[model samples]
Target chain A: MDNVASLMHGFSVALTTHHILLMMAGVLLGILVGVLPGLGAPNGVSLLLPLTFSMDPVSAIILLTSLYWGALFGGSTTSILFNIPGEPSSVATTFDGHPMAKQGRATEALSFAFLSAGFGAMAGVILITLLSGWVAKFALKFSSPEYFAVYFMTFASFIGLGGASPLKAIVSMGVGFALASIGMDSVSGNVRLTFEFDALLGGVSFLIAVIGLFGIGELIITMEEGLKFEGVQAKVRISDVLRTAAKLPRYWVALLRSSLIGIWMGITPGGPTAASFMSYAMAKRTSRNPAKFGKGEPEGVIAPETADHAAGSSAMLPMLALGIPGSATAAVMMGGLMIWGLNPGPTLFTDRPDFVWGLIASMYLGNVVAVIVVLATVPLFASILRIPFAIIGPIIVAICFIGAFTVASKSFDIWLALAFGVVGYLFKKLDYPIAPLVLAMVIGDKAEDAFRQSMIFSQGSLSIFWSNALVSTLMAIGVVLLLLPLVGMIAQRLRGRTAQSTV
Target chain B: MITRFWAESATAVATMAFGLIIVYGALEFGIGWDSSGPQPGAFPFYTGLLVALASLGTLALTIGRRIAGNAGLQESFLDAERFKRVASFFLPLLAFVVLSVTLGMYVATILYLVFAMRFQGGYGWLPSLATAFGAAAFFYLALEKFFQIGLLKGPLEPLLGL
Candidate 1:
């Protein structure tokens, strides 16, 4: 009842004329960003971040979150029409989405993707509304040791659960932490890793890193592939959209199951991309006629789309409640939260309920707006994709550089971005996971602070982590997660040895 | 052509070197724990060490795979044609960064777009110049005028003073 009242108040705070207009503009710009290759939700959000510097925190968040929803929707548009996924999360959509388009059911495919995505996002928001208070209250009891334990658990989970080689994951995460510690050490007040360069005083901005990695790095790969867009022409009829919407309820089982999977993944850091793939796999495995999955099955389209948006939205809970982002995009948004003079943790809920709840309330409005706007503008975005890559490509490059420069008006950052861009391209090509790096950079300093603070509390004794039951449980979980992969590998080897002996 | 084996090995070596560099840099500050707490360098030192070790592991794994006659390692990471395409795109991008520093971002934006459109895209001078100027103007209005954020300006902006 208290939570419901708070949400009603949140609705009041978010339901402003200015906010509604900003949401529309954000969605429109986000669709443009999502429709174009090389510009993803993280890139778009970071690029637009500078523009929002002057705005209030509430409006800034509204605009950015709306853009996020819009980008997710726009990603599916390209998947269905061009057979190219605009976002990593949308890749699974192409398996059946493009086939549906080829079969002249483009309208049905588009409508199903958007409507199911909307449903998933709503489910995620409702979960947030219901669970946010309990999470925040639970987190309020946390101390430095608990904080360190949480950060430990997050990184450990990534290494254990992520598909990348554990060694590569560790390397990626270590690089991010090292890079983050380069500038000033707030606790000790010592400049650590400047290497005597003046620019190293403030350290490397994660924003610059993101621009280089996702924006320029992705563009280079796209160029290497020599991509061409031979898109299926989409002609969405209002009647068809209505007809598709009517048929969505028939897949209630898939929708409900996917939403659960998405919410679980979102909260646990598997993220939207992982969630979508897992959901698609589950949908296929459970289907009576699995062969139809890649042959224009509606369930194929519905499952991934639902899970993607569900994970995208639900991921915000951990970011807001515990300051641990569930995905790369959430990591960027959490960075924005720090910049906006707001800390993203349990205190943020009590300190700025209006901001937290308003953002939550806006998610409801934004997804509804995203679906309507995307449904009506599919053809327009498809036509935009028809533009020559040579033109669109250069423009994206320009946007990236411009966005980087605007970060601090430093020419040095332009150079740094280019360097990271090369690193990004090479990392992508080499199968090195970049998310751990981004996540590490975002929370590196905080985690370090938590560890040092806990050490101080225990007079430099590492046992402080296991001092309390809460912290002990958290640390135990982290240790298990960290060792799980190694254990599995050893088990596999033992099994292989047994099989060889039998042979 | 570059094989996957070489590419993997080179990347592993590079990351290893990067980790060692961080480790060295971290030594400047004492990597110790005092009565106050862990030293500033302690965090980075361990992270750097972790990176170095993991990178070594990757390097060893790559070599072990090659030694075991992994056929996939023989495949090309970047063939000649793909290299050509990547270079063509990367060189112009490198030029744009250079121009952004010396010539300023707005002017660089215009010139880069025009060159890409007219030369690379094979579009007409009319459309190229039109797009070049149009995009520059739009960015000027959006970033500078609307957002009130000043972008990098070179000597040209001073001479074209209002």
Candidate 2:
């Protein structure tokens, strides 16, 4: 009952004439960024983050969240049209989307994708609306130790389940934590890593790091490919969209299953990319015509599209309800919340129901608006890909440098951005996971503070983490997850030895 | 010459060096448990130790792994053509930064665009100049006039009273 009432209030705020205009604008920019190769949602949001500093927090959040939705939709546009994934989450979409386009079913594939995305996002929003109250109530009981345990789980998940080597992931996260400790320590008032440089006093901003790592680093690689742009031309009719919408009901089972997979992954630390891949693989494995999966299967297109959007939207629930971001993009948004002087977590639900509800309402409205807007403008965005990459490459580079400078209006940040860009390029080349690094950088200081506070509460006793059942279970799960990778490797080795002996 | 293995090995060595440096620094702040509870350096101390051990493990595994076939111990980091292409953009980016500081942001952006389009993109001067000037004008209006944010201005801005 309260959720319904709050959602009604949320709709009132979100439907205002001015707020609606902001949503339209955010979604448009988001789609534009999403359609562009190499500029993903994280890079787009990071570049635009500094601009939100001047606006009211509520309005700013509406714009950013709407942008997120738009970007999620936009990534699919390129995948179906050009056989290129504009964002990582959309990679699975390309498996079937591009094949459909090659078979001259581009319009049908695109319409199916947009409709599935809309359904998935709405399903995710509904889940968030229902479970958010319970989550908030549960989280209200948490203390410093529980919060620290949650943070530990997030990092541990990345190490054990990130699909990368645990050593590489830990090394990357360690580097991020070390970088995070550069700024002034709030508790002790000591600066550790500045090394006496005046520019080092304020510490490194994650926005700069993001823009550098994703935006500029991506530009460098694009340049290495010789800055070429060539993609399939697209043309969609209104009838095509309607026809696909009608046919979409036949795939309701796939959509529902994918949404469920997406929501689970989003609520955990696995994130949208994992959800999309898992959903697509499941769809293939269970299909009557598995061989048709990568050869323009409509179910293949629908499955990943639904899962990606569902995962993207549901990822916000954890960020809002637990103060722990579930994905890289959510991590950046969490940094924005801190910048606006608002701490995320259960307290936010109680203290600022207006902001929380308004954001929720906007998600509902944003997806509806995005589906309509993106469906109508696919041709326009597809034409954008016709522009030469050499022309767009330098312009993006200029924007990155300017965006870095604008973060603090400091010239020093631009330099740091360039340095990080070089490091980012190397990391990518070496196949090291950058997401863990970004997450660790964002949460390192807070995690350390929580750990110290827990120790203080327990008078230096390590048992404080186990003093309560909730914290103990949480810590136990984190430890098991941390060790799971090593266990898996040993188990694999033993199996190999046994098989060799039998042979 | 660098192969995948050698590159990973180098990264491990660098990680170890960074870990040692951080651990050494944490020692200066004291890693002991004080009367209040844990000291400031306690957490960082553990983080540093983790980094050092992880890097050492990576180094050991990378060294022990055997290379197959005739690819040899070292693999070229990049083909000659790929290296050239990367350098072409990278050198320009560094120049963009240097020029932004001296020539101001707008001036640097315009010049960088024009130069890239002409030399790197193999385009005639007209379209290059038009796009360069147009982007600068758009940003000036959007960022400066509407957003009311001040950007780095060159001597030319005052001469034109921008």
The candidate scoring highest on lDDT is: 1
Cα deviation at A92, candidate 2, in Å, is 0.8
lDDT tens readout by residue for model 2, B65-146: 6343435335665677888888898999999898887878899999999999998899999999999999999888888988
lDDT of 1 by residue, A1-503 (tens): 87889999988988999999999999998888888999999989989887887889999999999999999999999999999999999999999999999999999999999999999999999999999889999999999999999999999989998888899999999999999998889898998889889988989988999999999999999999999999999988999999999999999999999999999999998899999999999999999999899999999999999999999999999999999999999999999999989999999999999999899999999998899999989999999999989999999999999999998889999999999899999999988889999999999999999999988889988889989899999999999999999999999999999999999
Best candidate per DockQ, number? 1
Candidate lDDT (C-alpha), each = 0.93, 0.87
Where does candidate 2 stray beyond 4 Å?
Answer: B67-76
Q: Which CAPRI tier for candidate 1?
A: high
RMSD of 2: 1.8
- lDDT tens readout by residue for model 2, A1-503: 99999999989878888888999999999999998866788888898989999898889988998888889988998888887788889999999999999888999999999999999999899999998877988999999999999999888988888888899889888888877777688678887766668898898888888898888887777777665545666788998889889999999899999999999888888889999999999999999989999999999999999999899999899889998888889989999998999989999999999989999999999899899889888989998888888888888899889988888888888889998898778778776788887888888888989999999999988899999899999999999989999999999999999999999
